[model samples]
Target: MTEGSKLLSEMNERSREVFRRVVEGYLSSGEPVGSRTLTRSMSEKVSAATIRNVMQDLEYLGLLDSPHVSAGRVPTQLGLRMFVDGLMEVATVGPDDRAALDATLGSNERDVGTLLDRVGSALSGLTQGASLVLAPKREAPIRHIEFVSLAPDRALVVLVFADGHVENRVFRPPLGQTPSSMREAANFLNAVAEGKTLSDLRGHIAREIAAHRQELDGLAQDLVESGLALWQDAGESYERLIVRGRSNLIGAAEAAELARVRTLFDDLERKRDIVDFLELAEGGDGVRIFIGSENKLFSLSGSSLVVSPYMNADRKIIGAIGVIGPTRLNYGRIVPIVDYTAQLVGRLLSER
Candidate 1:
């Protein structure tokens, strides 16, 4: 055998059979796997002593984790990875599940961001697991944008996009403003800024207006600066956000351990960390399954994030879709579900 193939660790046929049953059981129950459980469940003939020895070998190889003497062994992260990569069969979604997923992909008349929020909410509700939706930062094309003043000290900005999307923002006025002044600002902005990004237009206009030593009154300058700040800040506000299933996590985890769970709840209150994870996946290629130690942000809270890229009509990865669940997730089921959801998100975007 070649060196590379030989280095690929695996068990014999009989041991493989036992390991499969053990892993599946552990995933289903979030519990350890005792030799008796394997021996009784599988038809493979093996002595308890032999199974014990094999478990020892697996532990040595970092595939099985032995928590304590009285407890049984469980699959470690590497073991789970290997099982997912090599042994996972593509489990089909059932009829109700298929209908549900199709329904989710169908009901939204919203833009990408709102659609993602709906998806996240659905996944969390369906699986009773934490769900996260990640939208593409650099790819939401501009259709149209406008600004209106709500008051002398308050201005309203409305953004419209080619994808039949709209967004709104309210902010402080530059210093002093009026309804007629707001009209001039909106007319001027809409005329020159119909097809540019909120940020790009804001920056370009700020530079041009500031450079002009020529004309307007102090009030017009104030209107310009306030509009610029509102544009910049509102652009940031539209960024991808994370929505977690606190209840789902609670259901999956030991809710009895309230202190630790509360801290976990508090950590996700910012939603920034999960957004960072989405940004990382958007910056890369396709599917990403971040194990426990791979990311410290997740490691601290014992969570795992699985993300997959979704494309637009131009075949650009305009966003990503995935689930956020506890570390002891059923990768066998959730992995395929996540992959399928990503495809659905892409298809929806393409239609738009």
Candidate 2:
């Protein structure tokens, strides 16, 4: 048996029952649960004193904690982790929930950034917690490429991908460039952009130019090179990390809890750290849970994160989606919701 199972087996049946009741009660109410409360709900008519002794034993095992000297006990981080990993009965997404997700995410949205933003928002609304969406890097092959002159010096580069997603980037065109030259540049890119990502296209263009194979005027060649360089220089940080529904983190929090929530907000402000943390989820399978203190980002706030990586058609993990909430969140319900949403998102991305 696993260590957790063996440890759990050490407890008598009544102690295990009492431990489950206390955890359930604490998760439901976000408050300490006393033996008196468990005594009333338990099928076995155990005395409050007897239940209290069992609680003390559980506390000694580092699974429970009493905030005040005389107050009831709440599950510690280890206890919460144990409950979630082993005892929690994850609920499947019901028809209503699945339908709601489909309606929210299955729109005709062709823009990846907007779709992912909506995803984060939808998850936050459903979970009543802040949502994190780590979008995949732009890797789809180009389907169409065009250059539209926004001004004499500025031009808009429109790229439509094989997945039906679109991206627009602005770049400064070469001086004295005309509409005809812009058209030539677009033609050159579209001819070779057939099945290459933007980064790949840039390298291909450079090689073609260096080899002196393409017949193009100097101005048009310069425009082509300049536009691709500009886009590349912009890099992948644009909307790569998205966090939504932060206000939910602070909802009705007490003074001390509110302080912790503020700290979490401060942590969220460091998008780089959040991105780094989300990238770790890419290495895991299915839904991954990080409870209080497990992740330093949420350690100060004592928050928890539940995340899962989404995949592409090739079953390759691309990005991650998850929710952040208090340690007392309803894991039994939220775990399945996050898992289903991640799977749905993967299928959607694969189809596109």
Q: Name the top lDDT candidate.
A: 2
Q: Residue 290 CA error for candidate 1 (Å)?
A: 1.7
lDDT (tens digit, per residue) of candidate 2 on 41-124: 998899999998899999999889999887599998888888887789999987876777788776898888888888788788
* lDDT string, candidate 1, 1-352, tens digits: 4321232344677656655666787878888888877777768677777788877777777778887785488877777766666665656655665567778768747556767777777767766678767765543457765667677677777867765667787778776677666666665566556777665675777776667525645666666666676554335556475565778887777654445456667766755465466565776666677766665555656667777778878887666677767767766666667777788888887787
Q: Model 1: which residue pairs collide?
A: none
Estimate TM-scores for all models.
0.72, 0.75
What is each predicted model's overall lDDT from 0 to 1? 0.68, 0.83
Question: Model 2, residue 273: what's the lDDT?
Answer: 71
Model 2, position 29, has a per-residue lDDT of 91
Clash number by candidate, in order = 0, 0
Query: Model 1, poorest ten-residue lDDT window?
Result: 1-10
Model 2 ranges with Cα > 4 A deviation: 1-3, 142-234
